[model samples]
Target: MTLPTSTLDLYWLPEAVEFSTAVTALRAAAAKGADGNADAGAAAGTARMLANQRLDFLQTRTLDRAVQGLPDAAWGAELTLAVLGTGTLEHLLPAIRVAGLRRGLRVRCWQAPYGQWRQQILDPAADLHRQRPDVILLAVDPAELLPDLPLSATAEEADTALAARAEEMVGLWRTARERTGAVILQQLMPLAEPPAFGHFERLVPAAPGALAARLDEALVRAAARERVLLLDLGRSLAEIGRRSVGDARLWHHAKQAISPAAAPWYGEQVGRVLASLRGLSRKVLVLDLDNTLWGGVIGDDGLGGIVLGQGSAAGEAFVAFQRHLRQLSRRGVILAVSSKNSPAVAEAVFREHPDMVLTRSDIAAFEANWEDKPAALRRIARDLELGIDSLVFFDDNPVERDLMRRSLPAVAVPEVPDAPELYGQTLADAGYFEPVAFTADDAGRTRQYQANAERRQGQAAATDMDSFLRDLDMVLAVEPVTPVTLARVTQLINKTNQFNLTTRRYTEPEVRDLRDSPDVLTFAARLKDRFGDNGIIAVVIGRRVEDGRTLDLDSWLMSCRVLGRGVEQALLSVVAASAARRGVERLVGHYRPTARNGMVRDFYPGLGFTALPASAEDQGWSLDLRTAVLPQPRHFTLALSV
Candidate 1:
């Protein structure tokens, strides 16, 4: 047989050329004509091909290394990714693994496939006790594959079957989750037109006009009932037509098979999806003021002349972008501004702009000065008492963005979309802000910040701690683990670290099991003051032993927002009162130290609990209920109705 000739040509060849060079060497071996050994040329060519391929692999691997080295300031403290199963398991598996490698994650990926209506996904998850991933990405496109499932003959029948299937799937996931473990992330289908897989065509076989609407509704309901994270990639993808193989809009697969130019963009789309899922747990959205949120430099635009509304195209774009951010803020995204501008000018624009969607009250904190953007961001995080890793920084200047990207390394610095009009679309597509539900407490976040600012200002005026506490009009709501606060409590039990005594994270299923079991007691806290309400911000889990006579504080935590405001004291007091009422004679306070939880190292000791010397570590403490003082501070208008 004649030998295959070397006709290979490739761009972006690594330090050592792969296919091309290997083919060339093979061709050269053939030309040499090893007559004595007939297989000599073939052997040489095979060896050359292997070497080149290895080199090519090494080059691609280098890229991953570079990504791993990305500073914490670039993406946040840790990478928390929610893997959505687009039913594109073949396509997503590699990408998810890539995103997970070496990334600091609290929970790993959540996988949901459309073919089995989550059954396929659940079977694997049920056995995930040992390999507990931080978060689950239910990235299945139900619109694409659900039609292949067994559908009921009638529309009502179909709806019932689908709902039941969804409920069962969610139930399995809930069962699989450990106490204070695994966040469930569901990515909604981004709308793509026909010519590709035509998922839109199949969105609703039963209803034509409301197909997309119905799917969205199903997803929303499924997410809520399952207590899963919902990233709105659909809203953004709907605006920009989804690229499909049929349309040939995105040559992702072909490019991967061919070149690197196509590689980055294709990888970027996947990365964008992953980034959105990862950012769900991100605590802070740090923004740049000049040119990022508004058009023109505030110092140069003189505040009044700065373009920010409908009259101009750029201004309208910014207005729309700000509205998108406002939507995020209303969904519990903490907003902070870090701008290199005079506070006077920045404050004026916010005050004067009639069409401006954001206000001074909307921002959690504002760092306005000549400080470097990265430094300003660090300060913003410190002032807000959030981790630098919890920050997602957005800036217009490439230099500043790059500076922070390299130095801080942990913050998520999404590459800015080239055009101004695409800012909202790009950000939406990026999927960084996914929230399950917008509660009343979320809507009042800005007002809460304003209240905090007022309280801080009032601090200087107060002569004593009692007078300061009395002036704020703080209200504390203490209750048992009810359905309304269960979601928040579970979230705290899993995510809260610094103020967590015992550092015990509970899963929803575990919490539910606790509620059912007679031996366990769980409680949640809600605090509202002259500033506003912080809904279900604290949680505590306890177990009763010796016939309801003794209580062990299994898990206790409070959100840092209400940290300094005496919320912790109030929560513990309520727990103590409840335990006393339950006829318990003793209360136990537990502490377990973690790398980040040094803040709570002395929590039990500070709470006046006697330390137990049973273990070398300060693992346990106890207080006699009869003698323990109930810290019922008069400043808090406390009412317990549980």
Candidate 2:
């Protein structure tokens, strides 16, 4: 098969073109050589370049039919985003749409009128409140926020001004949440110019730069209280170079604060944030050992001879990459190895090498055999109980990377740079593991998965299922929803796929609404056994129906980690007892089928509920609470909160 003559072909296309024409060209390029034998890695790289060009072109050229021409029904997810900013954001729509399309989301953006952010946010009957967007982007400019701060102001005056600005912004965020209940994505103020005091700005607490820093800190604190997510526009600007991203001419002419040329970059940053919030963030990073972890193959080079540490330039580069991987691991990204080498040799490097930054303890699973990389990756995913699509693979060999791309197109196979020093930067730029919020549960995820592996091993050794569970010494806790557990419950509702009956996704605010509803009963499950603590693994929401005579199970999902541990049975037992206590005669359960939830098709039937005929994609089941016996697992000790 023939490859694209040059990756730069798209770059040479005319800068000005109709949006439809550019989109057609992009689709044609992506679809070229569908049955051909071109290298998958090269094709992916070229496609990305072409997509960037198309987005850039679209941002500058307006299309009357932009929204109508968007691909329909094929996106993995959909989001209604309301953009409320002080500056003109008409040019931002095309770029945001393109970014969302790249990330497999159909983004419908509604822009508030220019400079009407305050009116829109504060008014209860505004368009924003009426639209009820899923996410809100608050992109206010610093000058607009603190216009009174001048060069002559004293440090004390600057401090007071900054404090007032912080309070105003925080109040706005709280008001927006109360009105619309959408996840707030607030852009931190960027420093468009240097402090007027020059060197004295560093010395004076009230200088513009110093005040800006103080305001940023206050914003961070404010965000923590209300769970607001701050998009670090300052960092993005620094990365892209402030001079390249700023346009004074556009700011004066059209009230456009950011440069049109940088629209695509800003859109990309926003897309990553949106993806994380929608539960599309990647969960695993699968790495190859030879040439990826070190300078040479472990089988050929002894642990002492391999390059990984500070002695040489190449070695230091590998060390930096390993350090970055470790940092990612600390933030709950599971690390696994899928190397083609002797198992013994690989384990020795992780175990015996003194210079190794990543040890065997850091890895959740290690698959070191001379198997095809794709199979190894699949095994790793299964071992961790994660979807294969959630895994990101990295390898230095072009052939292996191409093979992975062709075989497992769902897996993200990033192009590793030839130079080792660029590895960490390249991975960081990809933003595959962006997170909306880091909870206590996130920090302990690696350990929890490791415990799962241990539990699996114990199960294998047990003679029967009953014996296996009994030996686990399991304890299941059922508790009413509280403020502390609300975030995790919402996360489970959004992230859990398998073993979910309805496959419903909810944002934090929606979860809060359900929890507070007088007619709804919401609770979470926590399980611990001889292995370890599996924190907040399951969630159940039941709605009172038929004048409180029946408890309808609105949603039920359990994490895959606790699937085989009888947790579901225990949860159902609790629900039944609760319903019976509430004078409910029967319990109703609904099952909605999705592509990812086939594992639970027989869930209600297996639990002795009578199925009623429903639509082709859904099933309804019911059980009489007065007569139906609650299934009790002899192995587990259960407790319920008052």
Candidate 3:
């Protein structure tokens, strides 16, 4: 349970000496735990323990070897990722696989021969065309793409070359995306080249460094324009330093753009993005009060005596950490407080402290009690209407952190620092809230949660469920999936689980196509109550089938916070009306159960859809458009904008 306080521990993972023994135990435990035994749980813990380590290349391979062949039951989600680049990608595969294991994914990878990425992408006969990849990472190195412009060339010449290269890459991305129906990821060229111009590197427009820099910026813009995820390898390279990640001898001997030694770090960078796409990224930040956020326990030290805010170094460090949390809140990362102190005493500091950066309102949930840390975290997730896995626990006490890690392997418990000064840096380094796209809903996340709290209070006060919903004036805005709502729609498509039917995920580009498609009936539902607005809470997609008489419900998911508020009733009503208007005779609803989406197992049957023939626990329900009389929304005033 010793927290890493210095760079000396960088070479090994926690308990590295016993890693091989642990792996052997893990294999035995996996088999023994399968027959209704506790061995599976032990194997999982061992896997998580080994997977979260900063291992050497060989250790990563060993972990990957053990986990890769496991059943889909062991992994949260499965996806095939194709890594194509101009350099030696074979060395990076083990890291990617191990990284996927860390992030709760079973990533199967495919690579083009040596450097035949272009032909693999362009020619239908290539092996890439035969495989259906969920994600494609174009790891094309800048050395292969960026031209060798002379030092005397003008800035305009550099701009022209950058534009051409950006277009070429974008074209490749579009072609690959079309061929594979996969999400595209573009890797930025790392700052591998030391400044040839040294101090004058910034002054020369035609220098190799200048073109590479320009190309990096160009690729970033292109990625944004095309909705491609940019793996900023350069940022990680800068952090790790090219001197460590780059090997000159290997580059000269073979076209190894990046060295094998850098695989662990490189894998982490790639894994973060790949995991994020599947809505596996954490959503909430739970902070401990005593000695974690500030210098002392407020229950004993009192507000004035506590060391926080300005003045002393310890006080300033806590303030800096709070400031970081506030910034995260502004970006839609939900904040919560879990403390072992009296609720009134802990909240008084937030309300009255003049130098407090995070006010009580900034936190979505505040759980202050004498309960154990595990139970406290569960209550926090329940209050937020999020799964236990969506929570990230931060505590300075090493014992509490260890207990949390062992108890909830799904929840992210980062290796925090013992010192107050390093708190913010450690949390930021964990990458728990890695975001791919920021929507309007994200910016106003705190307000939305606070509003939900008010709604919950309203429900508690009312005599009945019907009366409570009626008392709160709710507005359900049903809109067609337009460009404005595409980001939020795609976000909900991935992150939502509890109420999601089918649990199908789509990238932004694919969502855009659905928005523009004539055959798809897409609805993005937003709810607003008397308290405030709940930004884009639900998304439902209905696709026309070959039968032409039925509109198959392709996906239905909602934010769990808005579950009991009757949003589904109004949304389904609108869908029924829209489908009937399109001359469809029936609506087919599917419920493809996942581990996290069991809450809505009987959703279709509950809504009056007749049961149809099902396969392998997946139920199919059909509603006759000709004979069905769908219920009108009772609780909310509905606006159908589509």
Top model by TM-score, which number? 3
Ranking by TM-score, best first?
3, 2, 1
Deviation in angstroms for 155 in model 2? 26
Tens digits of per-residue lDDT for model 2 on 18-55?
54565455445334434343433343443333344534
The regions of model 1 sitting more than 4 angstroms off are 1-464, 616-618
Order of quality (lDDT):
3, 2, 1
RMSD of each: 27.2, 28.8, 28.3
lDDT score at residue 578, model 2, on the 0-100 scale: 77
Which candidate has the top score in lDDT? 3
Candidate 3 TM-score to native: 0.36
Model 1 lDDT tens row, 531-576: 3345567878889987888898888887755554567777778888
* CA lDDT for candidate 3: 0.76
Q: Give all candidates' CA lDDT scores.
A: 0.60, 0.72, 0.76
lDDT of 2 at 290: 87
Which segments of model 2 are wrong by more than 4 Å?
1-240, 445-642
